[model samples]
Target: MTPKQRRLARRLRQLRVNSGTSLEAAANHLGCKQPKITKIEVCQLGARPDEVRMLCELYGAGRATVESMVTLARTAKTRGWYQVYDESANPENIDFVELETDAVAVSNFEIDLIPGLLQTEDYARAVFKAGLPDISADIIDQRVELRIARRQRVLDGDLSVWAVVTEAALIRAVGGRDVHLAQLTRLLEVATLPNVQFQIIPTRAGEYMAMGVPFWCFRFDDNYGTVALDHLSGTTFLEEEGDVERYRLAFQHLCSTALSKQDSLALLRKYIKEEHSEWERRS
Candidate 1:
């Protein structure tokens, strides 16, 4: 299912539960089996606009809410632009790209590397090559190209981004000195964007909150949100209210522990100067 379908499915489930309606009752109202309702709620089946309106009405939703959901139902089946890269992406990564594309705002915390949306081509290529050693070079190139396209779509849209990276990321010098320098330059450029909030957790912070993993929380219209955790095995998306809330709190704490946006930019500048000076001396 597309991200829109996922959100709509979730919203429908919430509405039903809040109204004290059973799946059997919902199925009866729609003149379908309980499994159909289950499938709709789980995003295995797309809810038609009429069905969405009917369900909303049954759930005692306000007229405005009904209209809003019906509209989402109408558009939920549309394919995202990222589907073009389906051949190169795994199912989880494809879902992530869909969510990222649809999100109005994004909060990202990276532990040891630059956020993909803020990474340069050389930097992203290096990351893919390092992480997927067994994958064919062609696949790696496709992933890198997809990353660049994803970045452009998000930045070019009205998306608001708050990204926090560890100081380690800036100092690691990925893809050697030249690529690292260019990546930092790209980050500085992105940081200056009005819609982007960039911060860094200094190494001096010494074992801070969210020390173990990196995650992204996506905020969408209608106040729905989703959290994504990427691990070695695959990407996991969390939509449960409790899980989303926990990640949100963790992200908030991370932001508090990070350097302010202004200081983060200054830190980037400091690193860039050091890299340039080292390059000059070597040359």
Candidate 2:
């Protein structure tokens, strides 16, 4: 999920939680049941255009603020039809759908899945399968396609991205032998691009991923940096000044531990060579 959706979900949740608004009160105002209000507030349910309008009025969100949110929620829904695939497609992914393609500088720390912005179809499919173990086959494929498509947008678009990958990511082999091989090659392909930077934090570097999973920190031309945490429930974006500063420091620590660009490329190249050699030996 991009940071925006995380921010929206987080903001709405905070407002309700802080304002001491009861489900019955908000629901009563919206003419919907308490469960509906709960879903909207928690971002579990996709917000309708009119529902957003109504909720903003009930929440006493300011006139301009309400308009901006209504627009954001509408943008959240217009998803170019092809966006149906991402497994993380919730308020977070949707909220940032329109903004990410416009970002100038982006950095990510991937503890588990490929940086969402850089994943290949097979790798994405494998990740999605693990996340939605019970999903039907057709839906899984659609979602995988969507995820790969999103990654391609970042890779192919005019965005500059720096991704720091934990060593565990390289070793886990998300999609089995063939899938792993393809994903590794895909990384090598994108790593060659001028606007993209990729680094692998090897196990020898150790202790980082084990100590805590990685999160992404995004910086936009708006002169703000956002820290996002992805959870099983989806993603949350941190906006508090202290929280944002802490993430900046965390990213700097991670950057210091990650492999240098030249060495990181060599490591990936070596992995590719080893993969084919092992494949040839087995054959």
Candidate 3:
């Protein structure tokens, strides 16, 4: 479920609890089955706007809260922009996009490559090519475009981001010297955004808590949050409080071990200059 849907579900459950409305009672009041109520409250099913209104009214929710929840329900039912690309795309990837769209804050830790949100066009293409070499060119292009579109969150200044990347990711040279130079320069530009913070875990910071793990933690308006862990098969989205807390604590440790934002920028600049000199030498 998307963050908005989760928030709506949480709100509905909270209102029902506060009003002491049993699931059976709530379902009877709404002319629905008890399982349907359970589904809506757990975000396994999307609630219609009218359903939200009726539930809020039944739970004695205030007018402002009812309207807010109704709006949330409508949003939860709406399809995200990423859905326009291809319905056949991986469902987990689509879910991540939806979560990212609704997130107010994001924390990312990358080990092997730059985070997709920070990747430049050429750099993204190279990464996609390496991962999906057997795929058709058209599909690869589509994936690259989708990745570029994800950067809208940063460009639109709607989301606050804290990204920590390993030094190896910065110096990997994914698309050769030219692409690496552009990527480094792009990172420098992206880091200047008011809501973006970039840090680097030095190569020397060995034996860390998240050595091989690359994950992202998204924070919504409420205290609710989700974590996405990358694996060989696919991504894993963790919503359990215990799982989220562990990832959050891991991220905190990463932040402390990583170089400061200013120092990271300096490192980026140093690499950028070195890459430029190498390109000049080759030419």
Please report the candidate that would top TM-score against the real structure.
1
Q: Which stretches of candidate 1 lie over 4 Å from their true place?
A: 1-3, 20-39, 60-68, 281-283
Model 1 scores a C-alpha lDDT of 0.89
Question: Residue 117 deviation, candidate 1, in Å?
Answer: 0.5
- 1 versus 3: better lDDT goes to: 1
Error of 3 at 46 (Å): 3.9
TM-scores of the candidates in the order shown: 0.90, 0.67, 0.85
Q: Choose the strongest candidate by lDDT.
A: 1
Stretches of model 3 off by over 4 angstroms after superposition: 1-34, 42-45, 50-68, 278-283
lDDT per residue (tens digit) for residues 26-80 in model 2: 7888777899876765567766667777766777677776676666566654455
Q: Model 2, stretches more than 4 Å misplaced?
A: 1-88, 96-99
**lDDT per residue as tens, model 1, 139-241:** 8999999999888855785788899999998988889878999999989999899889999999999887788789999987666789999999999899987
Residues 1-283 of candidate 3: C-alpha lDDT, one tens digit per residue: 6667777887799789889999999999999889999998888998899998999999998888788778878888666789877643577778888888878899999997988898999999998889877878787788888888999889889989999999998779899987888899988999989999999999888878888889999987655578998775788888766788899999999999999999999998998888788779889
